[model samples]
Target: MNNHFKTAMDQVKAEEALILRTSSYLKNVENKNVRRNHFLQKGNQIMKKYAVAAALAVALIGGGSGVYGYYKIPVNYLSVDVNPSIELGVSMSGDVVEVEGINEDGNTVLEGVDVIGTTVEEAVQTIVESATENNFIEEDGSSVVSITTETDSDSVSEELTNAAEEGVTQALENENVEAEVIKSKIALDRRDQARELGISPGKLNLIQKLQKLDSTVTVDQYKDAKVKEIMKAIKDKKKEVKADLKEEVKEEIDQTIEEGKTEIDQTIEEGKAEIKQNVEQKKSEIKQQVEQKKSEIKQKIEQKKAEVKEKVQQIKAKNKNNGTQTTVESTTESNSQ
Candidate 1:
């Protein structure tokens, strides 16, 4: 019995060792799974962070291109000339992308004027009003404002030109400024030529017009002249040309009227001569017809007189023969008694 009890205790000890070994194996497996899951979750989180960063970079690049495209490109160009020449660059949405003075006077006018990102109308008004204040536009003297525009399409050019004209007029009126606003469109090539000469396109255009009216005028001669002076010269030249043309037309009209009167008088004289000749010819023909009728009546009367004389002589001869035959018959009867 003692040997059996010891064997039983050894068996119980062996079973307890097997159970502890199984529990230890399960705990090791659970720890391994927990560690693997932790690693996988950390890896997933790291990948998500990389994906978010890449998406943000793409968005910034795309948004940056859009910003550059809208704000950087210029779609139109314009210039204002009032003895102070200023040029402007316009964006696609009609904002003033750039403003620059082309000369010393232009710079003076643009001093402290900030027009970027403003509408073209507002920019134009501000510039013109500033010029007025600076005495570039005189209150007691008349002045001219020339606004020129250049663009890819005629419609846009006209629209911008009209807007500029309105803006200038409104500003001048508001300040009680006495000035004339002239609007025009400048071609691209002409604009470049104006830039080369260091003049606004509006001034260049006016100079060209002045040259046309007065052939003696040169572009360089009036390059530094004021716009008001150039406009006055043009006006005077036009008036002179108009007066000369009127005199020439009057002389031509007088000569034409004289020639027409002479032709009419000569035609009347020729008609009178023809009518007199026709009347004389008709009278001569009527007189000859009357003389012929008189001669035919005289010849008929002479023929009737000759026929009556022959009949009278035959009757006298017949009477004498009858009387002689009666006398002979009476003598023969007496002899027989």
Candidate 2:
């Protein structure tokens, strides 16, 4: 019984130790699971906050209502062309988003200028002022400043064109720069074409139209040419064409008058010839008729003369016969006597 009790106590102690170990292991596992759950909950909260932030960011960017959308979106492209051609990319709010020089002189004109974030008018004025300082624009009223607006929407283009014109005019007046301000609008495709040719759309368009009038007018020749120069060339070409046309018309009129005079002289000569021929023919006809009548009158007179002579001869013959017979009788009577 002592051995069996010892064995039973040993078995009970071993089982208790095993049960304690199992209980400790189970507590450790539960603690680990609780910590994992807590960490997962914190991570989920963090993920939710990040998701909300990301959604808000997407909404802001996608809706284009935020500051990033306001200043970055280009709504218009205004090109200021003189000797120095500068183009301003404007935002929807009229703020300038970019300033690009279309040519070498334009780049030189824009050398230290930072016009981004300014209004369209302010940018235009600044560029004009810079150009004036650089001598690209003359003080005399000989320079022509062409402002062309490029946009997809006509309304936006017109508005920006007017705004740019006003700005340039103001800048010129402020700088005491007397210049002719020309305002125009162009499509975006034309702007792209202009950029490809390294010229402003206004200049390119002018060159194109001038090309139509004069085929010798080339973009390469006039791409860097001043607006006033191009205008002068166009004006001179038109005058030349007008003068040529006038001369052509005058020549045509002179030729027509000469031709008409020649035709009239020929017609008069023909009429004179026809009149002479008709008068000769009528005279010949009258002469022939008079000769025929005179011939008939002479024949009748001959016939009358022949008849009278015959009558006279007959009377004489009769008288002679009678006288002969009377003489014979008388002679016979005389011989008898």
Candidate 3:
């Protein structure tokens, strides 16, 4: 009975040891499964992170390319050119007349009457009639009266001289200033006149004088010395008047010039100020534009980042079930090439 009891105790001990060994083996298998699951979770997290990073990088590259393209677009430019030209002519028309005679007082007098007419023929007839009626002819047929008309030429100089003498004689009689007719000449000395008048030749009143014969003076005298003396006196008086006028004009011109210079300087300064203001305004505008573009680019980049993040999340979810996939598609569907 004692030996049987000892053998039963040994059998119990062996069964207990076997049970402990089985429990230990099960615990180790559970630990290995837990480690494997943990490793898989970590790998999934790493793949998701890589996908997010790749999408972000691609989006950044695309956004950068878009910005580069936007900047590469050109703006239009413009500009203008200017050029600037003058023209200058003269016109004339009129008739002539002749007169000659001695009055009852028997003073030797020769006269030519001009019948001032629009037509040359009528003017001549009127002049002859007037001379005959006034008994101003010596009745010599050789002293025949004639009428002539000229336009735009120096050929009328002789006729003009005669007319001037006659007119001067008539004027003398009218003024009751005794004067005898000798010689007359219609002289046009632009340089001399301009020099004597102390004015630009363009400013001279030559055109005004040409418009009316009454505006001009006719010199009538028998003695050349007397005429010269009279001309000298007239020239001296004109010179004195011109000198006085020039002095006054010069003073006024100087005042005007000074005022104009002041105005110009002020205008220039104001223009500079305005230009500076405009430049500042333009700079501000440019800054605003740049800032606006930067904001737009930043928004676009952020949007792209968000899109990339979303795509990465989608890829992560898809890869969680189907694993990651890389696809490349290329098409060369050319009609000619």
Best by lDDT: 2
> What's the lDDT for all of these models?
0.77, 0.80, 0.39
Tens-digit lDDT string for candidate 3 (103-176)? 22111211343332222233323333343344433233222121111111233334333443454345334433
- Estimated TM-score per prediction? 0.62, 0.67, 0.27
**TM-score leaderboard ranking:** 2, 1, 3
Candidates 2 and 3 compared: the better one by lDDT is 2
Residue-level lDDT tens digits of model 1 in 91-117: 655668889998788899999999887
Backbone clash pairs for candidate 2 read none
Scored by Cα lDDT, where does model 1 land? Answer: 0.77
TM-score for candidate 1, please give it.
Answer: 0.62
Clashing pairs in 3: 98-112, 98-113, 99-111, 99-112, 99-113, 100-136, 101-136
Off by over 4 Å in 2: 1-67, 111-119, 307-337
lDDT comparison, 1 vs 3, better candidate: 1
RMSD of 2: 22.9
